[model samples]
Target: MEALGGLPEEAVVNSHVLQFYFHQALAAYRAGRNRDFRQFRDVMQALLVRPLEKDHIMARRLRLMQFLSRVEEGENLDCTFDKESDLTPLESAIGVLELIHTEFAVTQETMETLREMVKEAAVIVCIRNREFEKAAEIVKRHIGKEPKSQVSLCWNERQLLEHCLVCPMGCWGTEVPGVVSGMSYRVGSMTPEGVRGFLEKHAH
Candidate 1:
């Protein structure tokens, strides 16, 4: 907390407040609790995005301003996830993971209303500890007809050491196991129609 001006870089701890709030947001969205979801989204979005900005005005904060600015003008997710050399593996992982998690939290409710918006957006909900199974079950319930797969990201000391050797940046070390293509961010940025198609194709 001392480093980034009283806030952790990502602020997405495994069982922290953000995690709890995220689960709440997802629950609200799935239960069609739009009013609650919006309120929660607004608050959580503010906290989550406050520390992510490169620069901001004091006494007032802008959350997801970059995305908002882009969206207002009909731009897409054009930001690049370049490898930053300075940050340690843990730091980089936390930042990137939190970004993805926050993105999902803010959009989950809206995505429910317009599942097509996330049709091409691949839902990669990482499950570590018991929470993983719970999250997986929830996603399965929501994505009812689609085929879903689970990959383990839990590693012991030795395995982690080995993985770190290979993936030094720790961008996506052995902890996260899955078919990761170096192409898209998540779900490969499919259009709304494409998202629908992905679900349809996977439904069996």
Candidate 2:
């Protein structure tokens, strides 16, 4: 960073510097270094085009990202971006994510990451709104029929919804979450030996 700082302001727009900032921002994002990611991302945005210039679409999108980054970090910050016609907050956020996905030249992995984030967010919003069936459909459409374990930035829906099912009928998500559960049969409780023994016994 110090070495880069030493370069003349005219050098800031160099393609190499732009790529450096973009890669650094991506690295910071993957590492969960929010502040570092934002710093590098802002620099990358400036290199790509004039940032925070309301008249420019790219600038408005970058501003939107700044708000989203805070929300992703569990911050309670108010997001005050331009709302799409008749769209709810969650819907507007999803629209922006899709728009950014189309506009940015990101890798497959990065694009998938952002897609998953918005998908998960949409599911959460659906669940909150008592649209459990909609949430399940969203998961089924893109998340597939296979049971997925919780990963970075992923919600533990299996364990969570399963637990919700175990609770009283008063629970919010017991319906469609359990309705959309995979029918895939597990071979083992914990180990291959257990599965083998059970299979052997059943085979008899």
Candidate 3:
């Protein structure tokens, strides 16, 4: 209690509240009260699904989907840490897919289901992106126009270069075919980094 006193009041209150609630439930369980258990179970279910609606959780889920897609692509996604990427979420997923690719070594016929999972995940990310855009628009209307400095993504040369060199799918490089160009071929060569380099090299 003494140590926690300096912490945020909400954190302290939440901790003590949960602790007291758990104790009450334990006491109820010992007394054979079914209602307390049911309530606890309901609360647990809400906790489980609540985080799934968060942006970071959606990003993780999308990354996993990307990993599964690479398996479908028949690419050797795994290498014991390349000096290439800084290991963002997407890169970490690619690493996992690489492991799967190494272990299973996909054949032409083995990739059908994995391809479908990739498509589904892409759709999910697109939907999430739309939701975020709508939310941003609402906030923008009410809060007065946002500053250009706060925008995390806006397609431009320097921004593109920064994302491509470090981003997992290389940002717009390899992923353009499926979502951007509407062409789906097993392509890992045109990574975002590769595209950025191409532009920079040609800009001269």
Candidate 4:
């Protein structure tokens, strides 16, 4: 492998060496060996940063792996790290989505789905961080300005948007004061017709 590193750029890019490193990284992650995982991740990332064909399967796979790794890191920080020092995982996740969108030639449907997933995840993270305004902005951006006409959302996406619009401080409000009032107002604003519009728009 060390000798392979000295090879010409074209030869290296065409080789299976990166795939081998990716598998090693994945194995380390699965086995819960943090040190080994980091080492392998670094190796794979280094290779991935080089110029590769956009349509290359290995390149796509590596991008997906890196995205998942960032998501996992974010989740781990959310659960175990100190709030004061831990970086925002959602931010990293969103960044990966942006990179994939701009650099890859994925199908339109796949791109839209990826965008929706990222927005949903970002909403959850912002809510947890008590950044309600940012959460609202994310939902609005994805749903569009004229949700009734332009935004066709699935049931799950609708529910997530609704939750983002109304949920305060990420709490579902189990008997908290003012919870019922706030929730009721938001729910009332969402009519059956509105939901029908969303469902119909996304049905295709």
Q: Give the number of the best model, judged by TM-score.
A: 4
* Alpha-carbon TM-score of each model against the true structure: 0.24, 0.36, 0.20, 0.47
Candidate 3 collision pairs: 77-98, 78-98
| Candidate 1 ranges beyond 4 A from true positions | 1-15, 52-204
Error of 2 at 197 (Å): 36
Q: lDDT per prediction?
A: 0.34, 0.45, 0.35, 0.53
* Clash-forming residue pairs, model 1: 119-195, 120-195, 122-187, 127-132, 153-175
Off by over 4 Å in 3: 1-5, 41-204
Q: Which should have the higher lDDT, number 2 or number 3?
A: 2
Residues 1-204, model 1: lDDT tens digits = 434456554542411444355446445544546566556556655666544433223112132222222122121222222345432222222233335335333344333433322321212222221122332333343343554232222234224323333443444545354433222322223223433332233221
User: Model 2: how far is 167 from its true place, Å?
Assistant: 20
Segments of candidate 4 deviating more than 4 angstroms: 1-17, 26-39, 43-62, 76-88, 128-134, 140-204
RMSD of each: 17.9, 14.4, 21.1, 10.7
lDDT of 2 by residue, 58-81 (tens): 343453444344334322112333
Quote model 1's TM-score: 0.24
Residue pairs with backbone atoms closer than 3 Å in model 4 (clashes): none
